[model samples]
Target: MANTPHGGVLKDLHQRDASIQEELKAKAETLPHITLTERQLCDLELILNGAFSPLEGFLGKKDYESVVETLRLADGTLWTIPIYLDVSSQKIAEVGIRPGAQITLRDPRNDQALAILTVSDTYQPDKEREAIKVYGANDKAHPSVSYLWDHTQDFYVGGSVQAVSEPQHYDYVADRRSPAELRAHFKKLNWTRVVAFQTRNPMHRAHRELTVRAARSRHANVLIQPVVGLTKPGDIDHFTRVRVYKAIMPKYPNGMAMLSLLPLAMRMGGPREAVWHAIIRKNFGASHFIVGRDHAGPGKNSQGEDFYGPYEAQDLVLSFTSELDIEVVPFQMLTYLPDTDEYQPVNEVPEGVKTLNISGTELRRRLKTGAPIPEWFSYPEVVRILREANPPRHKQGFTIFLTGLHASGKEAIARALQVSLNQEGGRSVTLLLGETIRHELSSELGFTKRERDINVGRIGFVSGELTRAGGACIAAPIAPYEEARNKAKETISKWGGFYLVHVATSLEQCIKNDRTGVYAKAQAGEIKGFTGIDDVYEEPKNPDLRVDPTQTPISQIVHEIVLLLERDGYIGER
Candidate 1:
């Protein structure tokens, strides 16, 4: 039999009556407006769709406290995570939010009204306590903990929401399913036993094998329900992941599997998240949920230790199986046997047998280097989709960041490299020199450390955008701070390659080469906070290419940079 919805009943908060909805829509304009954050939008969608069943609205303080402390609601329903509508104090003052008041929740993206909230209570939450209890740590290393401390609003407002309309989505419309829709679909297909496999990453052969095995074990149909909501930082974007999922869907046996998209903003809470996910699956009419090792665990903490035990999520889900009304399918690690050309669980493999395994890091490295991804590890169609999304380093966009002291020949080298790259002529080349950026982008900015950081950050942002669009950005700045330069690299590397070139010309040489006498004026206290004189120029600890333009000719420095770019596959061989 299909599992019952959580709390023994699915709560439908949508205003199905057209007259009521029209009345609410007309009244929403007169009500106070509150903009919903991304997380809040995801929560609202689930709440309206009955995925968060048994609860008719965002939790009041009592339910929030109970869930945070004991993984249960105030009514004793098994709810692992607290869902609350957080608002800033300024927003509260603007909206005059109070008990018995009504407010329209506007979508931040388009400013469209999605729902209306009847404010029941407004109060400040103990974020630290919630973090420690729910995520097992108050440290910012955990993504959820960090969000709670840094991004969350100062006040939480609890209320029952009247759905004005479902949030708009333009992409993958056919794959997005609500809890009620999924339940009805399962019933129509006569799939009483459904096993749901949840994932935030791209699906590969191992994932397919694991899900298939899990379904076969329980004699159930499989649901590939991947989260399209906010996942960890640096995760593959949903567009690419969905493309990969679509490519892999046909590999499953006919009528045995289905693909669906879940708009879940994962908390990466590991054990608690495992229970939460199981409950959500149960509400979606799945009879079983797969709990993999380290389910929803954010990688490592600051001290380089795993945040949760390997089997902690599985164990926790198993313990709550009865209450959750869903079977817990524990996932085991799978390995490829080259001799048999089949994937087998590690425990089932014979000792001393040869097994082929590819780590995620290795796959990414291969992708970046234009190395071939074996079919045994992932399907060729999936790899092709990934490659299209994440092209090889040579084909992708990139930024060459040049940092040095003033008059260290950075501008000359930057111009020469720009000319060289333009001559090569495959991608658009943009040069962002210090003076040019100052005049064009940061005209109002000054030379303070904070201003300098902001200026560099702007350059990084621009460079990242250009790189993502497959352009070459050459940035020349006396970005003296290591932190700022590192931030630029981290930002640009997300979409394309970032190569830092340090022009390590000595301070004496720079002073000699300063035809404008800026360094001399700084030494004489005429110019305040002048780099390499009043202020310090921290040398790059590790740069992709380091050159002293004083010793190496301008052409040679440019050649070295081009060589490095070509060697790293950022450009074709000259």
Candidate 2:
């Protein structure tokens, strides 16, 4: 028999009655609408599809309090996470939301209405309490806690929903199965026992071996269910990860495994999250779930200590196995043994046997350096997909940001570097000079602190976009503030390499070299709030490259920068 859904029944909220759906569609225009955020959309999809088996809609205040404090619904059903529809005061006023009022929930990606909510109540939630009780910390270092504090709205409105349509997904349509659909699939396949492996990261050889071992040990087939929703901020995008997953699927024993995508917004809540995952897998017709070491752990805390013990997730899942109605298969840490040419569980290996393992950081470093990843570590196809998504540094995009005082030779060096790069002719180069930006991007913006920040932010946004498209961008600006420069670096680094070059040309030297008399005017107080005069110019404490135009010739400085780029593999060897 297929595994039973959570809470003994799968709650499908979609309006199957064609007439009722048409009526709701007609009423939707008159009803007030709330645009759902990315996380809320994930929640709504699960609720309507019955993946959140017992939840027909977002939780009311009573159920929210119960779930947060006791990890159960008000009716005493097991539910670890609190799902709420939060709105701002401005939105509440615009919609005039209150008990007994009905509103349409519209998808933010498209304006299509997905569901209708009849409001049961609206109340402010204690975020601090929610963070501490549910996520085990009130610290912003925890990704979910930071989101609760930063991204969530002030008021939460709760009610049952009447779904009009499911959230439309253009990608992987066939693989996005609902709870009922998955149960039907299992029934058709006659798969009596299934073990699920859940992950947010890309699967490698070790993960494959571990999941296969779990299935073999339990005499069950494998389900590779990877989360495709909002994961950790820097996680690999689902598009790339799904490609990797598809590449690795053939390695599984034929007819012994299957792959599916789960659009779950993970909270990284460690032990509690592990239990929650098991319940969700049960609803998907999986009889067992693999809870690996540090499952759903958010990694190190602010003090650099592991947030949860390696076995904490497994232990917690074991404690709730009876009530969850799903077996918790504890993942064994596996490492490749070079002599045996196979992976073995670390605990089962002989004491004197040599073991080899690659850390995620080391894997990325190898990828960036174009080094070979051993076949023992991952399959060639998987490596190929990863390499395509994240090319070698020399083939990737980058930004060279130059900051200095006015008339400090920044623009001259920037122009020279642009010419040199264009002459080299491997990739397109874009130069964003301070004057050009002021005239073009920030024409109405002045030199006040806020305006200057706005100017730098606009430059950063453009640079980031260019870098993402594999182009080289050189930005020369009098970005005197450290915060704005750092913000630019952070934004650009997400897409490609970001190198900061500080032109540490002295103020006295800049004044001496100023044939335009701009510095002289500033010194004479004719120009107020000029950098290095009335306004301060905060020097970069540790820039990637620092140049003094007075001592180093422009040609030599550019040569030095080229050498830096070459050394970091941002360009080919000279």
Candidate 3:
């Protein structure tokens, strides 16, 4: 039998009529809009499509508080993650946002309006408290907790949403299914007792074995519902993962398995996130969810400690199974028995039998070094796809981001580094200097902190694209702030290595090195927002490489930076 949707209702919120969509879009154009970030875009889609059933809109204060404190909604329903629309106070006040205000939510990819929200309540979240309760720690190491403290704003606005249109996704149209659509598909196929497998990473042989085992044990068909929305940072891009999924589709026996996509911006809240995943699967008509060891875990914290116990996710999901209306199918870790050429549960393996398993870190090492991935560990086709995506480190791209005070000699280092990179003669090296970027990209922008961040963002975008291709990019900017530099790192690291080189040149030396006399002009108040004069240059707490240009020669500094890159395997005698 098909499981009931959460709250016993599938809340598909999109308006179907083309004329009505046009009318709503026209109306939304005149209302004040809060542009949804990429993360918010992912959440809005699920909420609109009933994958997050019972969540008609962003959570109100009561629901948020209830979920944070107790993992239950105000009505005592099992709801784990706190989902809300975070808007900045400046945007709120500029647009006169308040209770009873009707506002439009615009997509950041474009200015197109997706929904109209009737603001019911606005409140400042106790972010640290929420982090501690929901994530089990107020540590910045947690991805969502970091987002809450860094990227999220002070105000959260909540209300019911009137969907004008669904966010447009050009890719993977066929596999993108709303909860209602998936339920209908299951009904059409006469599939009862569906087992759902959730993953953000690309699957391999062991994963296939475990899912097949879980499904057969439960007498259920398999549903591979992988997250296509924002996954954990540095995860394999969904396009490659989807291709890998397609390659594995034929591996399933008979017609027991199907694939679909979920646009969930994961909070990485571990145990809480597992319960949330189970609930979502139940809504999508899955009777059972496969919760494996360390399910949805974010690895380790900065202190080199596991954030949660290995079994915590499965335990939490099992505890709530009765209320969730879904069965939790627990599976032990899988390893290969090479003698038999089969996979089995770790606990069931005989003591004398030899077993093999490849760790993620080890796999990455093998990939970087172009080592052969054993067939038992992964399918050749899947490995080929991964290899295409992740070339050997020497052939892959990378970025060197240099930041320092004005006249700090970072520009000279950037130039020198670019020259050293090009000396290899195979990789294309591009240098982006802040002064040149100011002329080229930020000509209209000013010296304000916000403007500086925008300039840095532009530099990051360009360098990131350059790195995405098979090239080396060196960018020197007086980025001045950790937030902007971190943003740059986030962008570039998605494609390739992002090395942050901090030129720790003293202010006095920088002034002495200033032949242009800009520092003198800044002291005379001609340059208002001069960094290290009237403005601040927040030093990077843990830059990959910190150099003193005043003490180290340019050639030696460039050599040190290159050695750092080579040691990390971005370049070598490949």
Candidate 1's clash total is: 0
Q: Which residue window of length 10 is worst by lDDT in model 1? A: 6-15
* lDDT, candidate 1, 199-225, per-residue tens: 999999999999999999999999999
The Cα RMSD in angstroms, rounded to one decimal, for candidate 2 relative to the true structure is 2.7
lDDT (0 to 1) per candidate = 0.89, 0.89, 0.88
The candidate with the higher TM-score, 2 or 3, is 2
397-458, model 3: which lDDT tens digit per residue?
89999999999999999888877888876689999998899998899999888999999999
Candidate 2, residues 237-290, lDDT tens digits: the string is: 999999998998999989889888999999999988998899889888899999
Clashing pairs in 1: none
Candidate 3 residue spans exceeding 4 A from truth:
1-25, 400-423, 433-439, 442-460, 475-494, 498-566
Q: Which stretches of candidate 1 lie over 4 Å from their true place?
A: 1-15, 444-451, 480-483, 504-546, 572-574
Best by TM-score: 2
